[model samples]
Target chain A: MAAVEIHQFAECITCHAWSPDQSMIAFCPNNTEVHIYKLLADKWEKVHVLYKHDQIISGIDWSVNSNKIVTVSHDRNSYVWSQEASEWVPTLVILRLNRAALCVQWSPKENKFAVGSGAKTVCICYYEQENNWWVSKLIRKKHNSSVTSVAWHPNNVLLATTSTDGKCRVFCTFIKGVDKRDLGEGSSNDLKFGEQIAQLDLSVTWAFGVRWSPSGNTLAYTGHNSMVYFIDDVESSPSAQTLALRDLPLRDILFLSERVVIGVGFDCNPMVFTADETGLWSFVRYLDERKVAPTSSKGSQFSEALGKLYGQSKQSTSNDTVEPSKFRGGAHANCITCIVLLRRSAATTVKRFSTSGLDGKIVIWELDNSIDIQQPGYR
Target chain B: MAEEGFLEVENLEAIITRIEQKSRKIESLLKQSKPVEALKTALEGSPLKTRDERCKSANWIVVHRAMMAIKDVDAMFSSLDPEYYDILMKYLYRGLATGDRPTCDQCLRIHEKLTERAGLGCILRSLADTVNTV
Candidate 1:
């Protein structure tokens, strides 16, 4: 079977997220409407129309239970929508600090969520005891530029965030001091704010996206000059060794599993890499070049112009991080901006993936062993 | 009701006449090399109500012209400028190689005529090779 499937066409799909249970696929098109397609029913449906944002929706993520979804927008507000009374309703409104909210994520085990805004701060909003729902408690503000992406560890204890400042930081949540009160009016402080566990300085220009591995041990992030850095022991080391892919400027990174790292380049191709036991990474699968129709005359003309501008020098520069072998083909009609992997069931052996690009189309690909399964556990 | 009906007809006629007069003025301006002012005036006259409407209209016009112009070979040749002829030829060759599509045949014939007239042999062999691999 083909590794990539053209799922649907003609909608400006900006971001997509698979439900935790992998029963439904949620995508935001042009940031105008949030579309939810149920996999079981094989039907297309609009779960919510978020007309609140004057700008496009930048990021979206499903809650741990898959009953709710958190969305952030260029409008600088992060919204939480819940499925209640057989209808989707807006539950929480996280007011950001006067900047566009670029990314958002929900904690793995708790009701809390994190929002990364265009400002230099990453806000951690958890359920307030008085309001009975999630609210913001602006945590670390050390980032110099806007925080572009944020990811929560699978254990729900560590939170990783990336920013335009080219730095990624992991923050652990713990009770600094808690306040206790008996039936009396007097109260005593018992819990205090927790300190940051570690800070990984990437020192790159712009860190676009970050993702924590399934095991919560490794964190992958995209930086300038088409480089992707995989920090295996993020908690132990304050610096991550960068693994750069030559000639492919990656815009996003998604960890399909523990060893398999999928980096979506600005050229709109998904390059798969597998890390061996010695920390050496191997170029595994190039999913983009397969099953693409021949380029049209107009496409050729565009390619010729582009080739002239960039030149036909395929040689890898020594300063380049990843070797030229890591570069993949089968480019999209436009830049591939976002990608999400959808696992059907824990028992199921195969996992399917989806990618959305600037061309306003979503392409879904099914990964199976029949088509060159390079990774060990994949087969 | 009769008075209102008369007023509506008069308003429609007046608007049509005003549009015709403006179009003539634009034609004269274009001929006189005042294309920027003429384009500005034409755009202002047909100002789109919303951003979506404007985008839809622009896409419709481009697609419509491309589809309609491709229907006749003579018309396509007449419309092609010297600078765009090579680009059009490459498109034609690409289209023909894409066999099983009738549009490809149409484009091939156009390229054949242009190449014959300009005495430029098929320069798209390398491009064809690259596309066939993908």
Candidate 2:
């Protein structure tokens, strides 16, 4: 049996992040405010409400090392919230973009963060200790459309981003003052800041979620076309493989390990993809194993009369079609938008991961260790 | 601002002219009984960038003709490059949208073969893409 924990936090959550110790979560409830809830005793209690942005909060990430929360908003601003005493203080990062900020992520080192924007640019921001402020350098002109998501390689210097223009690109985000020159090897060490390193145009439709494996040798991303593309040997000769899913398109993806990936989206269930011994990725199975109830052919006369009455009231509709069900027969009743790693069994293996979606419920899924290690390609 | 506007219009005209030339070339290739080359030409610069009905219809006519002229379905599909799969699917859908009986029949035949060869990603990419339309 799959071990899972479900918590309903809001009516609809746009984005969410877990605290370092997994005691608290900060999530945007499809609004301009950020609500931080603490797991008190056995119940979740509201602890803080972060209100600074003028528009809807699009993305949020909590730093694992620094315990700071970084948020980006559609208002074209980003804020880094650090706890001082008991209150959280917000410091604004100067992201000079004329378009809305779409997504943000803290790099592995927690030294700098990258924010994707609608202006076809990504702003890599880092703190200037001398000035005590965050300054950003723009990665410009590479994307033909809005940058949808950003993921950092384990080295924290190479950044991968997906765009609406049907491309996923990896860029060198190593700033002179913020990063060590010799910290990264191969192409990451040699490329200048904001230089495009590799571009993957395997998807012919809008690409949404992107993630790098823990080893940073492989990258995976999802397209709106209900396909997932996995690229191996990204630094050298990049080879891409595409897996087409039969369900609705995935909006976000997470790497559980180098060989296992969990993708969630409009399908309302997390689907797993695994690489074989030959490193060819294929769809495995859904984490949610609940059998969807088949639609009944026989309709009750009362409901049929009601359907006709509703159609007559609306006047423009046919009486034959009934409204679609709100229940998708999965753990999430709506489209899942975000998945964050919660705990790890080892440096490379994920133990527990949490996913939150439009249903406003956060589901914590724990992977059975025995089954994971027995997989064909899993180490 | 005025210069930028004029440049945009001039660029659109150039694209339309280029598409027309490619369409005529595809017709000539079909006349020469080179269905494979004709199909290649039809898929070269697709999907047409312009939303102009005339440019789209002319390209579709050429693509439909090349697809119908092919005698060996399996041989043609076996030789077709994987890179052209998504574009070919798009043209098939555009052909289906015409609602003409022959065009729909030909497009359905090719669509079935292409989906079998390329798997489901080809169809998904064609339907999901809102940016690049034929």
Candidate 3:
């Protein structure tokens, strides 16, 4: 089957989350409400609208193992929704922060989720069986700016957080009561929640996105200065490698294999970056580079000019965030805001990925090992 | 819309970098007596006569700078014809809208020179034609 697009509204898709089975899609339509859609007969039908927040919804994540959805908003609220009696019920996670919740993600174990907020904290929220409510413990005082993005290690004990403060820190979120003992390099007795395990200065600008490698040995993040950085596991000290891109700031990133990463943002296309065993990161190629049709140099550059005019004409009708179409070859006409890996196993490579953008598009790219994850390079 | 704003600002930065690089390339090409090649390089990202189409292109700013470079540049004998001022004007207005102080200043410089070289009569004729056609 070809890639399916679920267009909601122009410039309205803030972010989106997909269920483990890829049957359901939940996205914030640039508002307080989270709209859930189900794939029905090769088309998406709006099934449910999750509402509660009085402000714009910033992020949403669906835990594949738990079959639950968590959403954070600018209203300083975070809700974990579970379906009971065929209706989604909201369980309020008590994220008592001074400012808005910016982003959220579930851990690999589905036992907990992390909410990055404007209050300079990442609230690691977990289910308190005793109280029957989700409770949050703070990873406090580490970040000076609002935490923009967060990713959890496969071990479920460590978290990688990126903040607008120009710092990306790896913290050991090993709660004594909640987390079971796991034999790992950083999971020592001295390790505790909020303890900074390793920190890397990504750039002078904000680190907008971060992702842990499948092996949990490396961390990759995109900086607001249009740079992609990687933190590799080097015995006790992690090594930081930065590759500066010539494009706009990449808003998000995802790993296709251990070495290949796809970054998308203002460039309006997914740029592939790769690393070798030497830990040197470099820009490999762009996924979408629209080839101009070969034409005789005789007449009508006017049509090409008119085509450009017609393309730009739509930008003015949307909100302020809608950029003029730049990626002439990419699927998404605007900046891609979110990207998630579609995987069959935790240990192997991700065969597919999905991206949602300001163009109100949901794009899926399926990969073949020989074609997409090819390791050809200067190495 | 926050996402859009973020993309636009970052894109502006990216576009500026690209324009700076290409403008230098054009300048160098002209210095090497390769005006034809310089024009070709200038037209690389933005298609010829496709001024309005490149609003999202990093080449938009570069195209403007390239146009100005050729117009001001003494390429052996002839400068870029005054007929291309409309294309330059398109980006000039859009660049001004960005409120980039240095860029607007550059545009003003180009504008003064454009009026002077094209002469007030041709400028008025084109302006009247534009107004009438619109």
Winner by DockQ:
2
In candidate 3, which residue ranges exceed 4 Å CA deviation?
A: A1-11, A185-187, A291-329, A345-350, A373-379, B1-134
Q: Give one digit per residue, the lDDT tens place, for model 2 in A34-149.
A: 99999898999999999999999999999988999999999999999999998999999979999999999999999999999999999999999999999988999789999999
1 versus 3: better TM-score goes to: 3
**Candidate 3, residues A1-379: lDDT per residue as tens digits?**
1133435443658899888888888999888898888889977888998888899999999989889999999999899999888789998877999899999999999998999999999999988888898989998878999999999888888888899887888888888678987554443446767888787864666778899888887889987656678888822677788775544578999987687888989766777787877767778766664322221121244446645654566665664224323333357778898998775655543367888888888888765555554644211
TM-score of chain A of 3: 0.85
For candidate 2, give fnat to 2 decimals. Answer: 0.39
Query: Which of the numbered candidates is closest to the native, going by highest TM-score?
Result: 2
- Sorted into a CAPRI-style docking class, model 3 comes out as incorrect
Ranking by DockQ: 2, 3, 1
Residue A160's lDDT within candidate 1 is 84
Q: In candidate 1, what are the lDDT values of residues A1-379, reduced to their tens digit?
A: 3245566544577888877786667777786567777754566555545555667788888875656788888887777877778667776576647887877777775466788888777777766667666667676457788888888877555678887777777775532221122213221112233356667765435777789889887888887545677887766553365654433466787887787777775656677777887766665756654322222233444445544433334334444323222322343666788888775655655667778887776777666643445633210
lDDT per model, in order? Answer: 0.61, 0.83, 0.72
Ranking by lDDT: 2, 3, 1
What is the number of residue pairs that collide in model 2? 0
Residue A249 in model 1: lDDT = 64
